[model samples]
Target: MNFPSKILEKSVEEISQLPGIGKRTALRLALHLLEVPKNQADNLANSISQLVHNIKHCKECNNLSDTEVCIICGNSFRDDKTICVVEDVRDVMAIENTHQYQGKYHVLGGRISPMEGISASDLCIFPLLERIKEKQVVEIIFALSATIEGDTTMFYLYKLMKDLKIKFTTIARGIGVGDELEYTDELTLIRSLQNRVPYSQDLI
Candidate 1:
């Protein structure tokens, strides 16, 4: 699609470069931004610029933050002994939305998928091991996706820490809280029953 203004075309092109954004959506967004107040557009541009320029990547957890340490890592109330290993910052955000976990996180950045040319060395696995050894992190919760890539990544991480006196567990995989048993897949239903925890009054 051709635009009257070259700037509009360029803006749409750049916006479309973002993941999951198509050219049409990018053009729509560019047009929407034009309709918004100048300051609003400026704020959006400035925020995106700051994400690349002014953001601080936490050395401890690789989380984006204003400081060297992220708020979660810096928070004293969070349990440091239990580290929830995840693939990316998005996973952290997803888990945080649940509000059920109070443990610290270790972002692997990406999973160990050879098809994607990503390996264990490409991730922050060494730092995790260092944290485990020096900080004495005891429990490791693999909160990754329940897929082939996620399973491969979890297995690789577990193998690395196998010698350490640490307890390793994957996030419980099964049907949702409100989901019907009949609607659930056979594998999910079986795993859910196998990893069932004792009934807790607090959970009710």
Candidate 2:
């Protein structure tokens, strides 16, 4: 059924391809965009295009940035001796929003999921090891999710970095099982960071 114009239908189809965007939501968004001013839509399109074309991974932490290094890596105010390892840039953003952390971040890009065919090598794990060797890092914090894949990745990292003298810690249990760090509230994230426990100690 061709209820809308060709452009509207095409826009809806494109929007529906985005994660969690169903046909109804896509159609609503397309209609809203059509009702908005031409300049607004053009600006939105231009911004998305620029983001797609210009953004690149940071050489050091593998975080998304427009330049070789991300702003977090380039910032002198952030603690250089501590690194918070997370599954993705969104997790970093979630922690940053809490304003309870002052250390640098390393985005793993993904978790270790054998079922999904993602391995340890698929993530930026080597770079994280290299960063620890190059920097005067004193600690590594695991801010990964509580999912099975996240746990597997954390265990892999712990074993890999066991020879190093740096302290290892994981975010506290406030973020319930099966809960994603990205979905965690600001207060809960902050409390989790503050109440982080040593991974080794918890194991014992």
Candidate 3:
């Protein structure tokens, strides 16, 4: 699209690079930002800058946070003996919205996908093992997506800790096959978590 100013065109180009945002949407956003007060635009830019530069991953769960530890990890009342395993911060947010789980979390960063060259070693699996050992965790809830990669990751984790006397469970089939946890509605996610079943190879 032709632009009256090279600066606006540059802004649209950068914004369009974001996921789900096309050039037209980016142009509208750029125009909106241009029409807004200078301080308002500056605030938006500053927030993005802070998000990029000041964000830290929680040392415990690897979730995004502004401090060393995330608020959930720091909470004294969350179930310390139970850990919910998820793929990333987005999954964590999806579950947290349900407010049905009171346990801690272990973010795996990503699932094992041979096609994508993502192996167990590339994820946060080591830290999870250490957390289980150190905390004497009793129950592990596999909250990964309902896809081949998610199942593969869950199976790998189960095998790694099967002999440790810890209980293994997975979210119920309320989540459809090939569904990502992050996209599941809160009601379905809650039901799935509430009706979780013992982890079995058949489920995989």
Candidate 4:
């Protein structure tokens, strides 16, 4: 059956579409918004609208940015020689929160999932290779998840960049299998990075 008001039902439906938010939670949120002051709701809506309108992917690393380049890429203090490769921008933010990595980042956009039809060509791998070729990158730290897809992507990247004389490493196995980098605690992430081992050396 339809709700008393179409607007309220529409608002609840829209909110429910958000990740992890169910219809009940969406209705609660919609009701809460209605109870709040109009100015406050307007400000919240305006912030989301601004985010949707202003934010864009960084040209260099594919991270979210308001401008052409992300803040990390634009920063002069970041170590240009080192690049931390991650599955998504959320992982980038997680690592940044630890303040353990002063180097720049390259968001792969996603991992390679052959079953899902996502391949090397589908991700930002080409741009990364191009960046490595053109820039003086000394090391690449892979901070992808320990999932099957994540492992496949890591191996693909390693093989692709093996010809280059750059040092490549992955975060230590402290993060359990199936664990996502974004969900990992700050201390654990920092420790994993600090104890990162050489990808090739560890394999042997």
TM-score of each: 0.91, 0.81, 0.81, 0.81
Error of 3 at 172 (Å): 1.0
- Looking at model 2, residue 93 earns an lDDT score of 91
- CA lDDT, every prediction? 0.91, 0.91, 0.92, 0.90
lDDT of 1: 0.91
In terms of lDDT, the poorest run of 10 residues in model 2 is 195-204
Query: For candidate 2, lDDT tens digit of each residue in 107-204?
Result: 99999999999988899989899999899799999999877888899999999999999999987657776889999998779878988767885444
Runs off by more than 4 Å, candidate 1? 199-204
Residue 139's lDDT within candidate 2 is 96
Candidate 4 lDDT over 136-182, as tens digits, reads 89999999997889989999999988999999998776676679999
List all candidate RMSDs to the true structure.
1.8, 6.9, 7.0, 6.9
Candidate 3 TM-score to native: 0.81
| Residue-wise C-alpha lDDT for candidate 3, range 3-62, written one tens digit per residue | 888888899999999999999999989889879999999999999999999999889988
